[model samples]
Target chain A: MILPVYAQVDLTNGRWRKCTISAKLFEQYLGGKALGARLLTDLTPAGLDPLSPEAVLIVNTGPMNDTGAPSSSRFNMTFKNVLTGGIASSNCGGPFGMLLKKAGFDGLILCGKAPELSMVVVEDGKIRIEPCPQLQGLDTERIQEELPERYGKLVIGPAGENQVRFACAASGERVAGRCGAGAVMGSKNLKAIIAFGTREVVKANPEGFEAHTRKWVKQLKKHPMTGDSLPRYGSAGLVSKANASGVLPTRNFTRGRYEHYEDVSGETLADTKLLRNSGCVSCPIRCERRVKVKGKDVKGPEYETLGLFGPNLENNNLDLINELNYRCDLLGMDTISLAGTIAFAMELQEKGMGDFGLKPGQPEDLLRVVEDVACRRGPAGELAEGSKILSEKYGGADFAIHSKGLELASYEPRKSVGMGLGYATANRGGCHLNGGYLALLESVGVISMDAQTPKGKPELTVFFQNGMEAASAAGFCLFTMQAMIPGILFKFGPASFVCRAAGKAMLAARPLLSQIWKCMPWIMPINCMLVPHSKSIALATGLPMTIGKFFTVGERSYNVERLYNLREGLTRADDALPERLTKTPQEPDQPDTVVPLDQMLPVYYKVRGWDAHGVPTAKRLRHLGIPLPEEG
Target chain B: MAQVRYHGHLADLTGCRQEALEGTTVAKLLDQIKRQHGAEAYRLAKRSHIIVDRRSAGAEKGFRTPAGLDSLVEFIPVCGGG
Candidate 1:
């Protein structure tokens, strides 16, 4: 039988060892984020500096990955975040994961720093580390171009070389953007990792898996959220919804509305700038925007890049946003964190605490600023540390716009309180996906519950978080889960009685839903159309997979990350938003317009079976089959 | 009559940012706009959410919500997912 296997590389000595995941662990966790988290918790040393050689980085693939499943060409990277000082798992859609798996390994573990700058290559189940001094200091695009085209490559650029706190690792045009994974590679003196192979994935139930993939692809194409909106405008389509709902982060999140929102909206991008819509491999929803940057075509900005760089900076220029996004990508810096930090710097200048020469609605010198941060030059060097450190040095902690040191995304959560709660409590820190992306239901999607209300948020947040966790762990794009809302809701509109009933039903089912997590291992039946992942996983791995077992895996993954953070000294105090988000109302006239985090946290903790201190109870950990931290 | 504001592509279909439409309910107002703009607006409207006075029209009652004379109704097309 084909079992999940991993390659452990000791970069310090250039030695490689291969090991198989025990059948028990394989059955309990899928091979992506869930398995990566499990390995991280077991192998990662406690209290090690995230940038140190002792800190290990794991890249893992899911069972469906490269198995001809729709939108399954994604990978997960788990490591300690330099910025958050907690567990980090970043996902990306690129050829690297597929190549890695096809090369006869489900995952790779990198430990110890290289003695010199080098590139690690894996081909035909063999691993080799080679010195590549000539490639040092090159940008991501140049490095990618210089690498052999036959092999899939992962590379970091100047931002990572400089060890910018939120540097990213790029694979093709896709990036593992959040959590400084690139910086960890840089610290190890690794420039890139390439994978090449000529083996086909072995599936246990090939026919069943093939049937599920076909049905799933058709379902994904038929869904409006994925098939229509995403394919047409990519993620940039949310600009108008965020703006109209008063949730668009403008001018360092001081306001939720932008006056010139349309200028940088997805509609404008589609009308004026879009070359075409692109996507990852096996994806029916081509939600990638290909637009011109400089004289050449490049991947365009997503909503986070557009919103943060556009309205959040008070700049109405989509062209400038695209250029900056390209710059961030090439430099290996995360656009979300980069934009959030710049917005915070702009606010710092507005407060007369410091002058970074940044201003609202100004595009001048922005490109220069991006270059400086990537190279760690002058004031940009300080800014490269992220907003959290800058806030500590300066005094705008209230308006720093970060959670647990990681910067917030474009969604202004004061309006979407569940998203606010998500930012505060996400294990990876201020991450939308890790925070369960409840804003899609509460504010953006057709499932319009009350955006500002905290009622049902804790339960809904838990439900969505668990569901997203399972889907993400199964290696499907979170966008694939968009079909779960049912297409009828979109057809009838959010104003229809059915949509309202749908929202209310979710709210009303909170009690039952809260209990479902514990009962998951037995109750959930497998289907490809609704919850297709379980059946897909079973057919692919020959494991006894069920919808219930899948939910258990998600729960275990989340709790494992939380326990890792807890062991690393993160507490409930760290699970918080900036004062600006909680204390200052988005609408000056409306005192209650701020996020009601205080009201939601206790309930959220209760539903998660955590203590008032926000740490999971021993009973809860035992119930999920996760090990309790030694300190706990 | 209610002042119905259109956003995103919905604005392009209706050819006006804001229109004064005669109807007692949001449903009737949307029907009038759909009839005037034809299938394009109808398709966009079906995918869009109707908000009355800055709040959700609470999907259950949808167009049945009272669009009273001075209400500011919005046809904000749904393009959410990032």
Candidate 2:
């Protein structure tokens, strides 16, 4: 079996299929983010309107999923993003990844639009896709309540039905919420996809799983930031960290730092509003915080959401923040996107851009806009299409905080140069979570190659992107480490362990990363592979190999993704960041503020063997098991 | 001279979180605090925020500023909410 567990759903046929793709030709490259993009290339239409039924959604799960890797629950869902006007890979976590695997599937691919309003229900291996007109007006809260108690449901809201370009799909309170995926579902007339199962995932080698799980879980608990600050405060804690640095997004990305930022920080929220802790299905670290707002507790207001509503618009009332958070979840909108939409409106209104219909610091007016956006009611609704669309209408493009049409999250690039590069070049459009290299750039500071200068940003960001992609492929949460530490970044990931080692060689390495990488370099991605210094896979899985063969698999997969994007036309232009970084040096509220991306991207591409266009060459592709484009 | 201010939960911990100290160097200021508040208090104070004027002033940097009897630095650790 190549891919351990994944599900394929055909909305038209109401069927579910599972397979292991680890042994597929591209299996050597491994379908991590790179392979997932390739798979979409195999299916998704080029230049097609993203919201059409023909557009396919590919959710990629990696081999290490549910194997107890730190933050191992993150899964990537790729689709044409109408909001960004480009491709996007949205990540989310809930029970769906583990359940599908338990039920014997590697990943889920939804194809062929439903004939009418319908919801596909997968229970006990039985698949049923049919029309459900009853779901038309329902929001995520309603859908979450109605879905089977033991199942995970993915559904879109009314904004999607209205074909609002910025609409999203939410699973429970966790949203694959960016890039208008919900809008795509709406276009397909597929209201929801509910998956259920009770079967246990039978491990091929339970001993290996247990050993890997214990080692990682212990390390995660010992991680200073993850163990102490994170679980207690959640990403909400950054509310204070960012604001204190004068790098918080306020007044529609107009400036960094908010006068009232301290009031809405994560610590304040945890002290006042945090009611409970929630998590995805099998995750031991319950990092998802449920906060009480307006008397009703809801999922969360993560860092981006806090930035969007708190500093971006100058709203500091935790009560209002709570209510706003609830509104986004129930309205079936993404908090990050919804917050940006409102912030954009605030900018237009403040600037007298024909009063584009909202005011800064007015929560009630913001709420009205939220309603309008979700239901596509009027001018406000149209303006709410997404931040980029809203910004262009207001006669401002340069000041508009978005990449490729997707609104930028809360990070102020002026505060950190590496993050500036990451935001500019994120595969999913202005998302910090996607690359999240800034976390490393500041504290852990990998690619020590250079941190103060943008000399090697592209390389740094790409390495993180590929490594993170590998982790997420295993369907793990990125929160395993509060910040991405260089040690873990270059160290042993158990999935890399098993993937690298041949039976006998793995036995000798027995938990040592170096041995695994040398023995099975051919099986893992080669660009940057880390293996156990010593460990025997044969003793556990009966498979053994030396380390040299393992590193190639991972490195090969990294290059394949670049080649795939090359096929889809993600060129030099696409590889660039926003105008803000390119022209004006970002100045923070503090002194010595200077954005440094001007020096980073070149060194980055060189390290990956990609030409200036960000395309991996023919030689790189041949090495990774990725087939080059056929000469016509 | 430097002014130190208390902030957030840390402010509540100190009896008077914000204050001004006279010294030519951070080490001198810290030494003065050691003599006045005792080593235990000075040790605890080091763990918190110390603002000079309005910008962040570390213990090392706060004491290094030109020493004088005037309070040109605002040593703050009181409002740190981040």
Candidate 3:
């Protein structure tokens, strides 16, 4: 059978080693987040700072990557978070994953630090660590332009080179934008990594994989959410839904609604600013919006960038949002964190905590602050430290609006309480995708459950989280997974009795679902529904990829990350949202409008089989086939 | 009569953002729209969520609910990206 291979690089000594994963480990963890998490846990030394020379960066692709699977040209980077000091798995959509595998490696692991500014080149199964000081300090776009277009390049810019806590790595306008992975690359004095190869990915069953791919692409194209709405407006389409749902996160999350939200809404973007639509390799949905920034056509802002840079900072200029989005991309900074930090600074100044010279409704200062944060100059240097640290120093912990150091996404959790639970308990901290993205079901998506209610949220949160984790591990775009919700549900409006029953049925299945999880391998295997990634994986890797096994793989991956975080000194205390989310109600007259995290946390812990302290029980770990950490 | 304002492509299909339609429930309003425009208008309506008087109908009031007298309705297309 074709087992996964890891190319291990010792950056300190400039040597590389090839290691094939064992069958036992391969069976338990597929590629991408699953295998990467376990590898990082085993290979990384304890107590190592994320930016230290010794910390490891593991880039992995799923079994179906480059096999013509829909949106399968995705990869994951797993490492210690520079901001949170916890497990961080950031997924990106680009040709890099396909190129990396074509170069004859399923994954690449980098350890130690280079002595000087350097670049790693992989071509035709050969690896070369070359010293390249000329590429240092260049913007992400200029660096990419300087490199040969034939190679898929992953590069960082000033934000990363300066080791900004929220630095992101850019690849063909796609980004691994969370957990400061780019900063870790910067700390190692690594400027960029370019991959080029002509190798073909061999599928175990070529005909079966091809049939599955055709059907999968058809499904994605036909699905209303993926085919029509996304391609038409891109992710910016969600701006209107989020704002209407009272979850747009205005003014550092002080309120959930924005009056001028229409100025930057997706409808406005599509009508006035959108130039064309684009997407990653092998993706049919093509949800990317190509818009003009400073007279040059570039990737438009997604929901996070639109909401955060637009309303969260109280900026009503869509043109400014597009400009900032492009600037952040060039600077290699995560917009969520960078924008959140600036918003936090603005609030701090408003509250008389510190003077960073930022004010509400002032969009002009934002451009200068973006530059300052990327270059680590002036007051933006302190802003580069992220909101969690700034709050600790400046005394605004209650309204800091972050969970576990990383800034919260644009979705205001008080309006969607389950999202609050997700933010508080997410492994990577303050990430919407990591927190299960229940906002889709609760308020934003087709199924409209009560947003402020906490009942049955824990179970739904776990279900979405597990499914998303499995999909990410399989190297599929999360948007493809959105089709898993039956089309009939969209046919029936959210207020219909059918939709409510569906919601109730989902919540009611918690007990049976928990039992099935406990049964593990004994449970009957099925391919499940619209999520065809498992079936494709089974045929491609010759591995048994039944739905049960797929979920188990995801569960194992999540538990392993939890185990790592636990070892790194994370406790239940860290699994929490800010006071503004949990205690303060968005609608003061309505006491129930606040996120009732207290009601959900206990139930969530119980469902996950973790003790009151949120540590996974040894029995739970063993059941998932994960070895307990030494401390355990 | 309920006032309906279309968003995204829904507006393009109807050739107007706001219109007055005679209907109590969203289904009937969609039926009237389909009769006046075409199947595409009905298709767009099906895939879109109605916001009654600026509040999202996804919450307590879905398409099944009545348009309540003089309710200013907004048809926002159902799209997922984030």
DockQ of each: 0.64, 0.12, 0.60
What local lDDT does model 3 show for residue A275?
97
Per-model TM-score of chain B: 0.87, 0.54, 0.86
lDDT of each: 0.87, 0.59, 0.86
Better of 1 and 3 by lDDT: 1
Candidate 3 achieves a global lDDT of 0.86
Q: Compare the candidates by lDDT and give the number of the best one.
A: 1
| Interface RMSD list for the candidates | 1.8, 13.3, 1.8
Stretches of model 2 off by over 4 angstroms after superposition: A5-8, A13-22, A25-34, A67-70, A391-394, A443-452, A481-566, A585-596, B1-82
Per-residue lDDT of model 3, residues A63-102, tens digit only: 8788888888889899998988989988899788889888
Query: Tens digit of lDDT per residue, candidate 2, span A556-607?
Result: 5455444444555557666555565456544543333555555666655565
Q: Poorest 10 consecutive residues of model 2 chain A by lDDT?
A: A491-500
| Model 1 agreement with the true structure over A445-538: per-residue lDDT tens digits | 8976877778888888887777788788878898887877788788877777777778777778888877776677777765446777778888
Order of the predicted models by DockQ, top scorer first: 1, 3, 2
Per-residue lDDT tens digits for candidate 1, residues B1-82, read 8998887778888888888999888778878987888887977876687777766676336667888899888888877585
Lowest lDDT 10-residue stretch of candidate 3 chain A: A521-530
| Prediction-by-prediction clash tally | 5, 105, 1
